[model samples]
Target: MKNYTVVAKDSFTVLGIGTELRSDYTDYAGITKEKADFWESIKQDGRLETLKAVATNNYIFAVNEAVNNKMMHYAGVMTEASVPEASRLIQFPKGEYLVVKGEAQTAEELSNKLTGIAFGQVLSEVKDVAYVGGPNATVEMGQQNGILFGEMWIPVVRK
Candidate 1:
């Protein structure tokens, strides 16, 4: 899967990747609060190890994660200076994306299906895809009961 460059919309997305502290995310509720800390700690202490674990395709993208309805507020530790009001959420880069399409029953169901299917199944069959969209950013398919469609987007190093 050779990477292609295309402009992407700027928006918010919940990035869920990297080795989960609690495998299976059985403790999903505890994940987010520790996410920033985990990222920062690695960024500071183990720069080289962090770089080796995986490659980063930093690009602007929009995806929806089902609001777990559980609020994990960080007291807005990020001040107004860091992020302007116009852009409430921040994405890594200006543009470019790798997209995947999927249809399923629920957002969660769809997400699960995509994770298991799009990446887990498809990539295994197509090894080059690893060189393209390195990792995906999950998006909650539009609101629907019992079923929905989700399109996963990843930042690929543009060809």
Candidate 2:
């Protein structure tokens, strides 16, 4: 079973790169690979380390939103500092969120697992405790230690 927690969070901002993604399940693999490639490029160019240095928190968030049936996926760090060139900034409003935590062997695995739990499990389970309709944001948080950990943050409102 997946372990999760419900918590309240304050408003925060993140700055990083992103790409448009389709919500169709068939496109999942391609989008996951694309995001992985982006992270790899950032690491090779030393941009990942730079963002980490000024990051307010250790969590690297993969934020997503649905627009016109397509998804906008953003891989970024939460920080108030000025981001490097080409990075877009997104602000997350304060709200209650359902947080699911887990560890994976690779970024691909983490992405798949988190997505499954967020949409498949959390969405179904949350109906009894909270209402998740409206404009809710989903975030996949990266690991902090040596382990490849991931956390899914789903914004919700108590029923």
Candidate 3:
């Protein structure tokens, strides 16, 4: 079973890149490829290091918006530095969030668990905690450990 916590967070911004994905949950290979490509490109061009240098925290975000079969996914860092020309910037306004910790042997496993289970559970049960919908921001925080450590952040407000 997975456990969650509600935390108040200040507003933050992320600088990186993104791509839109459209696929049924049963066929997410396309979206996975797109995310991998974005990360690979950034690493190849040394942009990842640039963003990491100015990052306020070690957490990297894999933000997503899934409505119906369409999803827009962003792989980015929480940073105050100017994004590279090849990258995009996303701003997450201040809000309370439902946070959950996750661990996996690989990044792919981590992503699957967050999207397929963790976030789903939070969204469905948030009302029990007086959660009110706010921004649609769903952020996946990446850990620096050898094992893939992640935290999923879902924005919500108290009713």
lDDT of each: 0.40, 0.68, 0.65
Show where candidate 2 strays beyond 4 Å: 22-26, 67-70, 129-145
Q: Least lDDT summed over 10 consecutive residues: which range in candidate 2?
A: 131-140
Q: Candidate 1 regions off by >4 Å?
A: 1-21, 24-90, 125-135, 143-146
Is candidate 1 or 3 superior in TM-score?
3
lDDT of 3 by residue, 1-159 (tens): 447888888887777566666555456687667777876876798776777777788766777755345566766677766755525666666877777777887766776676656545766865645444332333445556577777777777675
Q: For each predicted model, how many residue pairs clash, with residues at least 3 apart or on different chains? A: 4, 0, 0
Find the candidate with the highest lDDT and give its number. Answer: 2
TM-score of 3: 0.73
Give the per-residue lDDT of model 2 (tens digit) for 6-96: 8888977777666676436466667777767766877798877777787887777677766457567666777778655435677666988
RMSD of each: 13.2, 3.3, 3.8
In model 2, what is the error at residue 5, expressed in angstroms? 2.3
Stretches of model 3 off by over 4 angstroms after superposition = 22-27, 65-70, 129-145
